[model samples]
Target: MHILILPSWYPNHANDIKGVFFRDQAQALAHYGHTIGVIALQRRSLRTLFPKKQNNKAPHFELDEGVPTYRCQVLEALPKIPYGNYFLYKRAAKTLLANYVEENGWPDLIHAHSTLFAGAVASEWGNENNIPVVITEHNSGFALNIYRPWQLKVADKATQGAQACIAVSPSLGEVLDQRLPSSKGRWEWIPNVVAERFNAPASKKYSAGPTRFLNLALMTEKKGQYDLLYGFSKLIGGGTKAELWLAGDGPIRAALQELANQLEVSSQVRFLGQVAPNQVPSLLQQVDAMVVSSHYETFGVVAAEALMAGLPVIATRCGGPECIVAEGDGLLVPPRDPQSLASAMDHIAKNLSEYSPHAIAERSKSRFSGAAVAAQLTYLYTRLLTSNSKVSQPKS
Candidate 1:
């Protein structure tokens, strides 16, 4: 079926490293024989006063890896802008998308990623064009902290109107059901999938001296990088001989590094900023365990990938991590608690042999294989199209 996929974040030529998750899902849907068109929200747009700045990081409009994506730039220089403000972008994007679909034919349905922005867009477009929409909630609710007075009301209505809603983890689904209680739509559990490369053998080696812990999260406040550093320091003070390695980059990198230095654990904390996706498996192999301390997450892709690579994960019981990291696979700590994280780390370091890489990998595959995700998504799309088709028929 023809499908229009709208995502809040997507990888562009200028910033290919970001939004790799959205890119993977779009590609997988296309590969499964669905015609997919994308409208991604560009979170930043250069102001009219600074046209020169636009030249440096201009967004490119083209198809990347067979997914035709059109980006709608959002004005973000104004600091006080209300959160969940997608109407302007949606108006602009809908104009372009409507014209494209009119010249070509209308797609069967619109599939939106992330409830706040993409959900708003798909809701507006589907309502205007008399098409059905489906939303995949990727965040628990932290991203909605910036929403204005009426934004939540609008989101509630949009979610209620959708043909179906999907949550990447059970934790996210619980939040959605709680926030939008009026929405009686079918909510499905569809987690993200790991690529086949992650299941390959580990290419790197770890020394036998100290246990190495790896973190693969964006260096943002929600990721709780500072909390990780604080917890690691506490672990060191307890006489544990383990070094921490952090992967990924964000606005908080400098501050997190400073925090590490201040804690006198700079020697133990190594920040490997933004490794390529292909190089992730090798890094996972070299580490004894992976730690995820994000304050909120829709699904912890890195943690899942670590388990797929035959490595144990120690993640906070927040969002998707609570659902993905099970008893035999890894340890789950309370969110934003350094003491809890530290204790979990100490436990893993002491009993490292019990968490077998092969068993962890096998468990991860049961929940997050790419083929399974693709099939579930296809089912959702088909259901929406069939339901809408029947609704449009004349009464018998």
Candidate 2:
């Protein structure tokens, strides 16, 4: 099976941490014996804004972690141009497909990471070549609410044309269903996968701390970092003895740091900005629990990782986390409620033995392992390919 992935968020020289999950999936697919290739698209604007020293050396194609990647530049930079940037995405996808077909032969199926503009491009390419297209929608609640009318219309069109749709969680799939009901495609609920590397011995060794709580997301407004800090402050104020590890970097880092300072819990929270994907497991094993305060997540990959790390997770009643954190795995509080979040933290601190970090990690294997997810995805692609083959055959 020649599997081609069209991921809008892919790691590049400038943003090496971007879409590391998608890269993991691609690697898993390749390991499954599928002839996998990728057409990773980067916004031209982003590339120019952070021009790598290697930019002038031609578009050097390379194999990353065993997957063949063809990086194509999309925009000169994020365009402030007008109402919609549909043209930029379409042009990039068109160029990618053209180059892919010319150089590497046709792929059996194309799986797009987002239902944003990327789906439109995949639909166009699939239509042109009669190839099957599948889309995995990964968007926040805010984006879903703020999308323009035409954006929804384009998504509807693409959804209708797709062979199947995989939603990371039920809430996201429900939103997709409401937005585009006419699309005659099977919608499957596929959660994100965490790599085996994230699963480690809790007390075996190499953990950063003995009793730690971690927030492994970019520090941003939508991620609710400020709320997390406030909740942590409340927990500390209540005399809880736990260290907070804040991983990942974003625009809100300085502001969040200031908030921690104002709350006088700056020393308790360690900002370990941008840890590599491979290092996540060892880092997580050091922690006792993970906190996910994000208002929305298409799928909480870190929460799953924490579960895989055998650390209980304390997540908000946000769309994705509510679905992922089953009974006994963790607790969920209302989004943005510091009091409730703080209370949950206190409960965990007091009854640490109730939430077995090892049990939670074991439970995470079913939902977020690379091998499990890749098998499900491969099955979806194979089914679509076989169906397409039957349709194109001459009548018996």
Candidate 3:
């Protein structure tokens, strides 16, 4: 079956880590022998929209991760403008859909990732074009109470009209179900796909210098980087030979560094800003364990990735990590509690040899492998298409 994917967020040439999971999932589906077409809109400023002479605004088409993908650049500087989505993205989406249909024909399923505009676009356009639409929620915007009124309005319209709605974690599913009660009973909890590279760090050396703890989350307050620093400070207060790798960059990098300095853990924490997606596996393999210090998450992808790489995780009882970091695989402490997190860190550091990397990797693979995610997504698409066919047929 052919699948048309309308992603609300996608990795671009500039930001490879942004919504890259959706891209991976699309490739996974393509690997399953299904024809896939992705329409990823790059919301750019007015100046960036007008390139130095391109042929009729032809989409930058290329095969992304083995999936045929199209990047449609749209001007979205004035989000507060009237019908901003419709004018900037929705209209362009319709044109792209026409081009795609002309070349590849109508798809069996229109799967949208996230719901700011992709869900809305798929819902509106798919209905008009007589196609089944399914939306997978990835962001924690609604759960975090960060969504604007306009954003919520569009999100509701899209979800209400969708054949099915998916959330990356059970926690996120519950939050969405509450906000959109009418869309209940159609929610599925599917997680982000972990890359095939991450396997158990079975070759980890115990006496290889100071123990390294890897945290690859964005430097934000919500990510609890400060708490991690505080916890690390306490853990190493007794002169424990250890180092912290703070990966990923965000708005609060300066503040997090300052916090580390204030906590007197600055010397030990290495700030690795914005590591590429491809480099994560090696980092995981090198580290003794992974740390997820998020205050909340839809599904701690980093934690899952770490587990897949055969490294145990030290995660907070944040919204989603607790679900991924199972017993024996990792420790889950309360969010934002320095002393509790500090204690967990020290305990894990001391008992590093007790955790089985192979077991952790195997568990992660069972849940989040590309093939596994592909099977689940394909099943959902098939079910939706079958139901839609039944609904469309006249009563015999």
Best-matching candidate per lDDT? 3
What are the per-residue Cα lDDT tens digits for candidate 2 across 231-301?
88998988877778899899999999899899999899999999877677778766788899988887888
TM-score per candidate, chains pooled: 0.86, 0.89, 0.92
lDDT of 3 by residue, 1-396 (tens): 889999987887533788878877887788888999999887777777657875434347887666777777777767677567556788888788888777777788789988777888998877776788889988888898887776777888888888889988888888887776666666788888886767655565544778789899878789998888888898899667789999989999998888888888888999988888888877777788888888999898999998888888888887788679888897998998988877777877888889888888888899899888899988888788776763353211
- Where does candidate 2 have its weakest 10-residue lDDT segment? 387-396
TM-score of 1: 0.86
Q: Residues 203-266, candidate 1, lDDT per residue (tens digit)? A: 4333487889999877889898888999999999999999999999999999999999899999
Residue 386's C-alpha lDDT in candidate 3?
Answer: 76
Candidate number of the best TM-score: 3
The models' CA-based lDDT, in order, is 0.77, 0.78, 0.82
Clashing pairs in 1: none
Q: Which segments of model 2 are wrong by more than 4 Å?
A: 13-15, 46-59, 76-84, 141-143, 184-186, 202-210, 389-396
What residue runs in model 3 are displaced by over 4 Å at the alpha carbon? 45-59, 201-207, 390-396
